[model samples]
Structure formats: structure tokens, C-alpha cells
Target: MLATAQALIGRKVDIVTSSKILAIRDASNDPNEG
Candidate 1:
């Protein structure tokens, strides 16, 4: 799952990973989005 996320976001596993995770969750939970 981490590998998949890294590939999708083109980011490395580091401190910012947690923030990126929150962003992903927020995007997924947005009702106004697809």
C-alpha cells in the first residue's frame, strides 16, 4: 500500500508522508468531488 501510494504521488517515504496521507483522505472524503 505504501509503495502504491508513493508511486501514485511520486513522493518518498519520509516525515511528510503523514501529511500527504491526510491530504489523500481529505480528497477522498470530499462530497463535492468525484
Candidate 2:
């Protein structure tokens, strides 16, 4: 199931991974939360 989804959305995973990394970087810059 998971593998099928991964195969179906390989390009999406790349985008999602970049977005998640950006979110984490932005989160790190914020002082309100850890």
C-alpha cells in the first residue's frame, strides 16, 4: 500500500520533502515554539 502510493507520487514526494524542509527551517526561526 505504502509502496504503491510512493510509486504513484514520486514527484509529489520530492515537492513534499522540500516543503517539509522549508517548514522546519521556518519553524526553527520562530521564537514562540520549539
Candidate 3:
């Protein structure tokens, strides 16, 4: 996903890859969240 983001923006991205992931919420289908 990080690679994709960098590709879209055409720049290096700074992210906390070592940190523990807290939550991943998928609200794609929900209109309110989207």
C-alpha cells in the first residue's frame, strides 16, 4: 500500500512501518464513511 501511495504522488513517503497497527477499518461500501 505504501508503494502504491508513493507511486500515485511520485515522491518518497515517510511512514511508521515498525509501529504496531491499531485498527484497519474498511468503509468503502458505506456512503457516509466514503
Candidate 4:
């Protein structure tokens, strides 16, 4: 299920922009809750 979603997203994103989108998403969802 997860792999399918990943494949869909990969197909939708342009290669150059995907990394930046992922970086922003990761930053916004920071796990260290302190």
C-alpha cells in the first residue's frame, strides 16, 4: 500500500522539485518534540 502511494507520487513530481518538497515536508513534521 505504502509502495503504491510512493510510486504514484514519484510519477507526479518532477525530479528536480521532489527533493525540495520532501525536505520541506520533513522539516514541518519534525519528530523531536521538546
Please identify model 2 stretches exceeding 4 Å from their true place: 1-18
Write down the lDDT that model 2 would get.
0.65
lDDT of 4 by residue, 1-34 (tens): 6656877777543233458878677668976721
lDDT of each: 0.69, 0.65, 0.53, 0.60
Rank the models by TM-score, top first: 2, 1, 4, 3
Residue 2's C-alpha lDDT in candidate 1?
Answer: 80
The residue pairs in collision within model 3 are none
Sorting all predicted structures by lDDT, with the top scorer first, yields: 1, 2, 4, 3
lDDT of 1: 0.69
Candidate 3's displacement at residue 15, Å, is 17
Give the lowest summed-lDDT range of ten residues in model 3: 19-28
Query: What is the per-residue lDDT of model 3 for residues 1-34, given as tens digits with 9 covering 90 to 100?
Result: 8777887898965443443442233334454742
Better of 1 and 4 by TM-score: 1
**Residue 10, candidate 3: alpha-carbon lDDT:** 88
Model 1 per-residue lDDT tens digits across residues 1-34? 7877887898755434458778788778976954
Q: How close is candidate 4 to the true structure, as a TM-score?
A: 0.34
| Candidate 3 CA-lDDT value | 0.53
Off by over 4 Å in 4: 1-18, 31-34
Give the top-scoring candidate (TM-score): 2
